[model samples]
Target: MSRGTIYNKDTFLTNVANQLGRKRQTSSVSLPKWKKSPQYDVFSELSEDALLDEFVKQCEAIHTEVIVTEMKEIQKVCEQVIHDLGGESLVYWEDPRFIKYGIDNVLEKKRETGMDIYEWSSTKGTFNIEKAERANIGLTFSDVTLAESGTVVLFSDKGKGRSVSLLPKTYMAIIPKSTLVPRMTQATDIIHERIKAGEKPPSCINFISGPSNSADIELRLVVGVHGPVRVTYVVIEDE
Candidate 1:
């Protein structure tokens, strides 16, 4: 079977249809309209400011630090986070958004000050993963932020390694205010719309909430077992 092609899908379906003595239905069906769509209704009345407030509240509940600041102060806030986290080395995605949002300045200044910094690069191959493993911090921008769950959605690609957020001791996300949504429902809708418009969706979409935590080990809550121990959200209020 070819890649992306289902192995014997038509034959399997036809066999099942023959057993039922019916023809295979190939027409599309319309979905029933629901009376109540609570998914869309939740936080529907909230203004942008109210959404940010809710996002911050949710972040606090999850033990993630939320630093709300304007665009002009982004570099300063990033520097403060690095200092507070004792980040001697950093790894981040090669996203242009970092440069657009002033995070590039932090990388440049920190590198000048003798702190090691690595950007995810396809050409670097496993070298990116190796550096990310030893790096103290990993930084990236959230494609869509879920205000209700305090989740930062990342669209990872060749230039954006999923391990950039997964392998670091501390994970930081720059969340644009405009990317804030009420919940996962809105986030999926955005992705669905992109697909409907003939756009190629990201290969990997990660919804990270705070830091990694699990209660699977004897029902005891453990942090950083699967990923970063500390998570920080730097919200650009003016964006």
Candidate 2:
């Protein structure tokens, strides 16, 4: 409206008003997000038990083995898995969540197991990953477990580094029952809530649903092409 203005001030004001109106409408709009999304989720209902059952089913479909056990039995299962895999070397994240479950201490008595147990390093490059690549088994504590897709989420940081789960031949994730959610949307909501509460996410958030596999090469399926050949999920109910 200024005198001798080169631009169309009236038109610009009208466009801005339109945008403001849209924003206002958006602010007042509401959608039932908790309800199943027709475009994404297909489940009609999901209870705690239903979620666990669906999660196990999906995991198995992707060649992932889900083992439900008590907290006391977890250590025994990990040791048994090491023996069964003939694992000469093992690696795990140093996250305190795993420590609370005694997973970190499992490797403390490394000499007795006769296997090299390495912790994920914050340092980059070959010096850090050399031990990880040689390890036959890798262990990690998941941030969230999505029941709909059987997905285990891990955020890589100082204690929970990336290589421990990625470079190894086989990967095992220990998930607490409380971390399980009905779907990816619910999991993301919880993450967002954490962020709003001043919890900073790590540099990387890895979602592992099953073993690494591909079928594109010569139209023949192959495992361990991109990452671990086998993936295991050990769910602790009492955690």
Report, for every candidate in turn, its global Cα lDDT versus the true structure.
Answer: 0.91, 0.78
How accurate locally is residue 43 in candidate 1, as Cα lDDT from 0 to 100?
93
> Cα deviation in Å at residue 155, candidate 1?
0.8
True lDDT of residue 55, candidate 2: 89
Pull out the clashing pairs in model 1: none
Give the per-residue lDDT of model 2 (tens digit) for 109-148. Answer: 5536677877676665465588888889888888888888
TM-score of each: 0.91, 0.78
Q: How much lDDT does candidate 1 score? A: 0.91
The residue ranges of model 1 lying beyond 4 angstroms of the native Cα positions read: 1-9, 12-22, 217-219
